[model samples]
Target: MVKTIITLLMMIILFLGGTLFGIDQASEGIIQTRGYATADVKEAVQPSRDEAGNVEVELLGKDLQQVTFEEKEQEFQEIESSNFTQKLAGSMEKGVSSFYNLMIQSVYQLVQVFF
Candidate 1:
């Protein structure tokens, strides 16, 4: 019985390891094929000195212009004002419980199959 249990555990470990490896390989392939892995970094915008000798920097891209300090502050305030942490904790708890239940069920099925 002990030998059988050990064999089962080893098989489960191997299966999980193979699945994870396969997923990692697939994701890497997808990234390479989609050109996501070869993206070039944009050149940094150089700061210019104004008439008053004060250094002024201008954002070069539309993406940079879309993001502002006020927008970030508002997003932060919304998160702080809402029960974000509590909600996150609740969702995480549910996910953990469901995963635990699934593991239990799978183990029970495996035992039944072996017996």
Candidate 2:
């Protein structure tokens, strides 16, 4: 029993260590990618001071785009009126309920047969 317990404890520790190492590597990669992205963005947006000592920034890759408040509000209104999410949620709930009932019935029948 002690040997089994020791083996299980060692397995758990190894599993936890591997999980932590994987998470650390994943996070390090994400941080490095984000750093590169930030560097690229910084290089794209060049900042300079004019003769008047006023700071000016220019985006090199693409033209600056602006979205009006009315456009955003219209989008929000359209999303609210769609009702697609509500319908999808209702369908999913019905499916889950049906599956639950089927599972329960199957289990009950199995128990009756065994008993």
| Candidate 1 segments whose C-alpha is farther than 4 A from its true place | 38-115
lDDT of all predictions, in order shown? Answer: 0.81, 0.84
Q: Candidate 1 lDDT, tens digit per residue, 1-115?
A: 9999999999999999999999999988988886756356344575567676666665554222235679899999898889878989999999999999999999999999999
Off by over 4 Å in 2: 36-115
Give a tens-digit lDDT track for model 2, residues 28-115.
7987877754444457776677687666666875544445689999999999899898989999999999999999999999999999
Residue pair clashes in candidate 1: none
The lDDT of model 2 is: 0.84
- Candidate 1's error at 105, in angstroms? 41
Best by lDDT: 2
Displacement of residue 37 (Cα, Å) in model 2 is 11
Q: Model 1 residue 75 lDDT?
A: 97
Show pairs that collide, candidate 2: none
